[model samples]
Target chain A: MSAQGQELQRQGLERPGLQLQAQVARSDFVLDVHIAQPRGRVLAIVGPNGSGKSSLLQVVAGLVSSAQGIVVVDGDTWMNEDTFTSAEKRSVGMVFQDYLLFPHLSVQENISFGLRSRGSSRAHARATTADWLGRFGIAHLAERKPRQLSGGQSQRVALARALVTQPAVLLLDEPLAALDAQTRVSVRAEMRSHLSQFCGVTLLVTHDPIEAMVLADDICVLDQGSVVQCGTVADVTRHPATEYVAKLMGLNLVSGIATAGTVALDSGGQLVTTNSDLTGAVLATLRPSAIAVHRQPPQSSARNAWEGVIRDMEHLGDRVRLDMEARPSVVVDVTSQSVVELGLQPGQQVWLSVKATEIDVFKAHDEA
Target chain B: MTTAATRSPRRSRRSKPPWVLAIPAIIALAFLLIPLAGLLMATPWTSVGELLIDPVTQQALRLSLATSLLAAGCALILGVPLAWVLARVQFPGRPLVRALVLLPLVLPPVVGGTALLTALGRRGIVGAPLESLFGITLPFTPAAVVIAETFVALPFLVLSVEGALRAMDTRYEEAAVTLGASRMRVFWRITVPLMAPAVVAGTTLAWARALGEFGATITFAGNFPGRTQTVPLAVYTLLETNREAAIALSVVLLAVCVLVLVILREQWLRPGALRS
Candidate 1:
């Protein structure tokens, strides 16, 4: 295949997929988004709490009608202000965070439920269920009730049940959020594999950065019901459009205190900034690595430094994290080499320093 | 050693029970179980078989079974929908409607029978028109038997199924809905199947209530030998004529109740039993 053809195939757009542009207002939040996924590509929506991610999914699936705007999938209008199709009429599949398996149905029965609705014969539904169960490696669990299955097994069954109907689009709402940390790692990987192999557009929503980075071909960052950023994983990681996204992606953010050229730490204290023209309390963010820890008050031209004690220390891979209870109790990241060099330990005294220019400040919104 | 010492000290204090807590539980158990035991002990065992085999008794038993079963079946058909509407949908007077469904359950059975008679009897406000238009009278017939039993038993099924529906995770229905299944399909294929155990349990309880129906059946359908006299009515009539026969009939009813209870225990009450 040519490069363009390869790219098109990767997007899985044998037919055009969904295009949704809608706005719904709450007393305190406004949901504004315009997004489209190529026929079979996976679009991951990432956001903090109250970001309207689930509402967007509900609108597209026709569970909730949008106050205004359109939801078109594969050239069919599922939801428009003038026309609203019920959720039942939409060929969309959802995998809820809790799995939502029918407690009374066996694994096989759950998988065959949607198939049976499509006028398929019992035997045919059973056959389809058997095929799906086998494909998902849940055939052995076919006769067991949902309550009997482990979390991972039930998750696979739920996925198989959603996929058995061959829906045109799939929506997964924080699919791995209910699992334990250990189970989430494996289940997320398995779900990612299943999603990638399936030939349908999938939209996965999560607040977990690792899940979005691993599973989504493209990421849409929603903040307080609005799309703050939309791009590939690399683009979102390299350049976040909102303070929430920056914090979610593990950036240490602070905001300017006022016109005094000093940015206030989120906890307390203030840092003199290099940007003299920036007024108001602006959001400031920096990588943890950008801040360095010193055992004693070190003479440095960096200009921003505070003396404090190491409140805590945690091991993250090859690095050691030091929580310094300085003016603002800032977290400083350093190599194990530096930990050994500075003899860093919890309760050890330390001084923290950061370059004034390393801080990036932007105006913070007073209202959501 | 430290964990064990700390746990045992806490366990010792926890194991000591208050007389105040034990008194109510003991009284509650006795209050519930004593009547059942008395019913069993007072049964005239010697004549029980003969009383059960009497033609009149047999007829009453059969009528009771047929009417109660029919009523329970009807309740299943209508009550499930009522439950779904009450549990899942929002509308004006929803709370009032839910309370109204339980009206028959809490109202005296005689009042319920009277209510049914006034609503559907030959000279009833609506029934008068129905009678004039269709030349049909619904009182004192087998149909009346079914209606009376349904009136008394439907609330049981509705309450049980409604509780199950309310407790159910609605996300499953949403999942099925998004899977291209219509609302009706989701109800039948997902919601109903998930609630099968509660439905079955409710049906059995409703059937039992209908079988023992006395006041409503006697008032609405009358104590006709084969048409309306259920087990409870038969026992009442025999009590007037023959005390031993009445006691024997009670034993038979007791045996059936015990059998139903056993079935319930095995099928619905057992821990870890699969509902599907």
Candidate 2:
């Protein structure tokens, strides 16, 4: 390697890897997070609303308040104890949730904004912008203003515009969130393909489970402004450590205190589980599909039973999700045919039965 | 198509509008229009060209245009930055500062003239030092006319541009900065261009106000033909002796006011221009 390459490696930015340790105080919400990723990887942060997902991205991009952090990206120490880089100086690209394309500028100018700002001649910027337009298959929209474009076209333009800067660290905040459901699938595929070609550290913030599962190499679940679980997509889905993560994977999570013989739930209920000699706090999860719905209380082999009114019923194609207001308020998924057989309305009372073996009980805290 | 008035489905079923409201509306319309109608009636139409060609009248008209334009230029240079600061920045006593900027709008022009005299007149605070140091007396000069006009006209420009700056979505500016543009570049390229319609509206308003200025110009910058006497001040002098010439000049000023409103309606005041 050349001397410059070795210096870049020393700064930990040669391969477009990222290391960020930051703490920011925003009104009542304090965000204390440490995130790291090697180059050529995408870290998808899945979180509920108001979970500091966007703020985390903002701090590393040098857009937010005076966050204390050491942000080393692509061999540049953008921020640390002594150095602080403004958003205008740091080569960071972000696609905001709204896209925020300059409404007054044409598609070409929007894409070429970064180049023009970097002091490129108008002719060079225009040529590079046109190249990106062609690459993104949006050359036909080169002259059209943002308002003249459709939602899908605007999203494509936003993506192309971000990549035109050739940023070392790419940040996407809910990139697919603005599209209608029909456009999301096709756009997601296109976005995934484009992201795969980029040799950089990409941090994607999304609330949708499918978006995280499909696009991310690893998943980092954030709750209340802290990372609750970080692992491969399959691992986090299979053994979620938090209730929020369980809900994302379409499972009913029940938190309980495990004694010698039984597990006592916080919502005034007890359950018998197959796991032996578990103590202190534990989280037990049941697949929504595994719970059986009955009109009357059943005396079957199932070890747990609860009678509750249906709080909400969401029709999910062939299945219906019953948000039942039982002792612990569990989500039960039943087939649409069974929903009709049981004549389930939101106010109708029903019995829920779950076998002991079906519940997966794990220690609630990773430290514990 | 949606904005073109659809026939009111409910109007046909309702009774006629009350005479109580109708009478006052007619009175209000006539009250404002009758003076204009009388002015048109009084204009000496026959030798109007010869009257306009008269050297004194021409000079006052030229002086009026010159002073107002210069005042508008000064106001533009100063008011734009003030408006930007007022709209975009947070500071202590902002409300008080804004109120002080708008004081001239509510103060009678004569009172504003008196205030200007105490501040800029030869015997006054800054005026004494200026006169002693530079040997330059500002009163009874064209520069004084512009000073008076700018003093009274700045509020209009500042208010309009500030409202425009506040209404614009600041996200575009943030995006520009994120794209590596400096704050100055973003302001020039993004903020100023977005403020175009409002700035034009404000400039026209200030120009009209300056051209019609009588009290302040006459008091601070004494009325002198071909110098400080604008059209309104010239008309005031003519009212004492030459009624016909005064009427002609009044007609001229009225025509310019109408012309300005017509041009304003076509450009900045149009519904379409304000939408963006």
Candidate 3:
């Protein structure tokens, strides 16, 4: 194969990028999103509650009409002011949050629904449905009803139904939100591997940061019906554009004084961070897992150490959360085994230690 | 021993007569069934075979069956579309239109007979034009019997079907639309199937109403034997001549109605067909 062909085969997609801009007015707010993604790439939309992530995904898939703007995919204008394509006509496949498999139809028949809509004859549609079932490893479930299947199995059937028509763009809305936590992890990994091999523009909407980080090639953070930030995972983790995003990343974020190389705290303290280049008031973030708790002040080269009383204790599976009364409040995660070893309990005194390199500093914005 | 002793007071507080709620339900059942029981008890069993075999009575029963079945079919064909409109469509006077549909249901059957006559009588307003244009006279005929039955029975079908359509989720229709089916196709394939139980129930009720139509048929068609005198009219005419025969005919009507109700309850009120 030629270089371009090889690249196309490797990426599993080679088409023109999709361009979309929309302004949709709802009862409470207006959702405005502008996005562009190359073919074969997956873009994840992540946001907190009440963000218009699902609405934006629906607009791009032509399930809903926008009040303004257009969606152009692969050189074809799917929607515009004067002209619009219906959901069935647009080559966009959507996996709904609830995975609305037709209750009256069997798994095989459900998979054949979109293919039949595309004008395939019954015999041809049957062959295609069988092939998709085989591809999803659900051939044995061809005759089963959706209500009879496990959550993961039903999700796979939903995916098979969406992809049977070979749509040019795929939309998944909280696809794994219905699964149990253990199943979510394994199913999400399988979904990521399957999606990576798809030769179309894929958009996944989720509130789970882990799902977004694991599944998306690029992340778009949405808040209150607007795109707050859009970048690669590394860029977003290094610099979250909104307070919601920072909280979703589970960073112990504090905004206060930063002068020279050490930043002073609002509750009276100073700590060193990796961002020595910053010289003004800044926001600092560090993960709870990155901090270490000590019995006494250890003679380490780490720049962050403070005495604090444990305010709360929470047991989360194998780990325990220790909420300490440090400056601006400090939270640390320790293994349950270590909690037993250290005899950590609520109201106990301890020394909290964090490395300077682990602290990430950014210019503090008053609003966020 | 202490725990067992402590439980008696709590158990006493929990004890309430569970049958207290059945009192009103038992009274309602008696109110509905006592009249039918009275008719059954008064039936002259010795004369029932003779009454049923009477030539005029047999002719009226056949005509009643023919015209009521035809009327019910007509109601099904026209009423379902009207019900769909009233339930699903939006218009300025929708509530008013819905109320108008139920007018015949509440209007005295004799009043409905007069209304049908004014609309379809040979010298009546629109009927006059129809007669002049087509050389047709609709009054005092079997056709008039069918018209009167339809007039009184159509509201049952429409009301039942409209309630079903209103309760159905429109999301299924949208899903069908997204699956590339046109609106008409969706209605025929999805909406109709989902509303089948209601349609069947409404059809049976309307047919029963049409079979027993008396006032409208007597006023509109003027009680012609073998043409407009159905079973109900036949029973009324026989009351003056032979009270035992009339009582026997009432028993037949009651049996037929009870049988229909039992069949419908068994078929449509079961697990799969219980539509909201």
| Predicted candidate 1 versus true structure: per-residue lDDT over A9-68, tens digit per residue | 334333478777777676687888988787768899998877788888888888776466
Model 2, which residues run further than 4 Å from truth? A1-16, A251-368, B1-23, B262-276
Which residue pairs collide in model 1, if any? Answer: A254-A284, A256-A282
- How would you encode candidate 2's per-residue C-alpha lDDT over A316-338 as one tens digit per residue? 55667777888867778788899
lDDT of 3 by residue, A11-86 (tens): 3323486777778776788888878788898999888767778877778767676466667788777776666887
Instruction: Give each prediction's root-mean-square deviation over alpha carbons.
Output: 13.0, 12.7, 12.5
DockQ of each: 0.51, 0.47, 0.25
State in Å the error of residue B45, model 2. Answer: 4.0
Q: In candidate 2 chain A, what residue range of length 10 has the lowest lDDT sum?
A: A1-10
What ranges in model 1 sit over 4 Å off? A1-15, A83-91, A112-135, A164-167, A251-368, B1-17, B20-28, B119-122, B127-142, B266-276
- Model 1 Cα lDDT, one tens digit per residue, B1-276: 999989997997788767898889899999999987887787777777887788988898898889989999998899988987898899999999999998888889998888889989988998899899999898899889999999999998888788877777788778777766776778677777878877887788788888878888888888888888888888899888877777777777777777778766754566533221
Q: Which candidate is the best by TM-score?
A: 2
lDDT of each: 0.78, 0.82, 0.79
Candidate 3 second chain TM: 0.85
Q: Please give the distance, in angstroms, between residue A200's alpha carbon in candidate 3 and its true position after superposition.
A: 1.7
Model 3 chain A: ten consecutive residues of lowest lDDT: A5-14
TM-score of each: 0.73, 0.76, 0.74
